[model samples]
Target chain A: MSQELSDLDRRLINRLQDDLPLTQRPFASIAEELSLTEQEVVDKVRQLRDDGLLTRFGPFFDAEALGGAFCLCAMSVPEERFEDVLTKVNAHAEVAHNYQRDHALNMWFVMATETRGDIIRTAREIEHDTGLEVLMFPKKREYFVGFRVNA
Target chain B: MTLDPKDRAIIEATQAGLPLVLQPYTVVAETLGIAESELLERLENLKKNGVIRRIGAAPNHYRLGMTANGMTVWDVDDSLVDDLGDKIGALPFVTHCYRRPRALPMWPYNLFAMVHGASRDEVHAKRDRVAELLGDACRASDILFSTRILKKTGMRLRGQKG
Candidate 1:
């Protein structure tokens, strides 16, 4: 799964992390700035996504700002049943991001939904499915931190 | 911020992702049966109103050589967590930082900062720097490394109305 990326790919990856202009020809502006043709830029992005280098692309909607709610939930699954429990938990679309963290409460995930009430509802549903208590850590205050990876 | 039907449609269309084409917005606008200018204007407004954080690509950190992803949790004094959290969030290596309520007994940490590095040793070194910055203000801390990414689909608005 690991492959060496060219200098052009690295530079393009870094630039794409920043906000893409909201223009009719957004990729054109990016191509001009990166000194590449529009087709080259688009092709590289598509290639990156195809190769699993990039997860997803486009508008990152902040659920909270859009009247949606997000909650960080964790569960301690038995070692033997980890996979089974994961399948059941991930079945819900509300389970946005799930990570197997190294801790007593091993299974950590985030639930994003349209309403705060829905967060609890989905948690209950998961608990019923997996029979594990879901610990909810609703963010009280988010410190302004920009998330960017140096590729 | 209430979303009109058109706005919801736009989100539904692009939430998965924009098409990998030269004229991505034009494609999306056509799919939604609207003018390209209207789609661009609505997108700009969504960004201005904070609905959209950014329109860009999310590179896989692991693929980018950031293999170690640690969630550094700290039990900072409630009185000073805000001030200290602001400082920790500003740390160059810290990616996402937030202050959440602690679940008593089992979970006592309230401040969470995500740190990524090439290796666990590097992550530990960065964690040490965070400890130094926190000093005595942080009562106890722990680091949790993600063993695997079970799922990574980001926030999605369900098609059915709530």
Candidate 2:
């Protein structure tokens, strides 16, 4: 929470992840309901994005529907080679999230593929190219974890 | 209009708790006083327009026997991120991977991944595999197991009151 946002801002953000108003005057309709002008609503949304409070404002597609498989994976790299390994991991479009943590296994990321075979193939390729062991932990069961950041 | 009144109503209703029946659509249609065909058509349009991503179930993993779910973070090289991210994202078990701003003060990891398994040991074994794949660039990594599960649901359009 860097700076306090107006009530209208919060409401707009809450709706961003959901179905956006699918109308010619989507912003205006939402504004009317929230008792704010369309311009004001748009302005607030832009500000929220700029503030980094909103990671993304769009639909979260069902990966399974597309016949894609996803899971979490991580690896512990020597402190010296951290930068080189990071570049190698982020090059792939399937790698959605990558972060650093405070532990022996300091780096983690998520991977999704159209098929299980692809997931394995990609992991093996990375290991071959980087010459580091990539710990592949496929998700056996998925527990939804919703992350919300206040603006 | 991207979503009509009826379409909005349908989305609001089924955002969570999809009817658990063979003809869930029919039941939802009857409740909304719309024909099943009409409901299905609207949903199709929404999907085409990228409004509603998809209609599916979000199961409770813990109940399904996956007791351990951990967030694995990595510190990947900036130059290799795009290449490695694409390969990592292709993994079936590697769900939901994306680039995020790193946390400050001692934590400098840039790659993040998640794994779900029956037990903690299973997750650790998978971690070893990922480590083998990452090779020299991987400086360090760690897993933060979920201690508790909070509210889990589809997107909520109407903000909840405090």
Top of the candidates by lDDT: 1
**Per-candidate DockQ vs. reference:** 0.68, 0.03
Candidate that scores best on TM-score: 1
lDDT by residue for model 2 over B92-131, one digit each (tens)? 4555455544543345667766766778898787667767
Q: What 10-residue stretch in candidate 1 chain A is worst by lDDT?
A: A1-10
Per residue, candidate 1 scores C-alpha lDDT tens digits across A34-83 of 89999999999999999989999999988787677899999999999999
> How do the residues B71-144 of candidate 1 rate in per-residue lDDT, one tens digit apiece?
99999999999998888898877888999999999999999999989899999999999999899999999999
Residue-level lDDT for B23 in candidate 1: 88
Chain B TM-score per candidate, please: 0.90, 0.78
Give all TM-scores, in the order shown: 0.89, 0.47
In the order shown, what is each candidate's alpha-carbon RMSD?
Answer: 2.5, 16.7
Indicate the residue-level lDDT of A4 in model 1: 90
Error of 1 at B52 (Å): 0.5
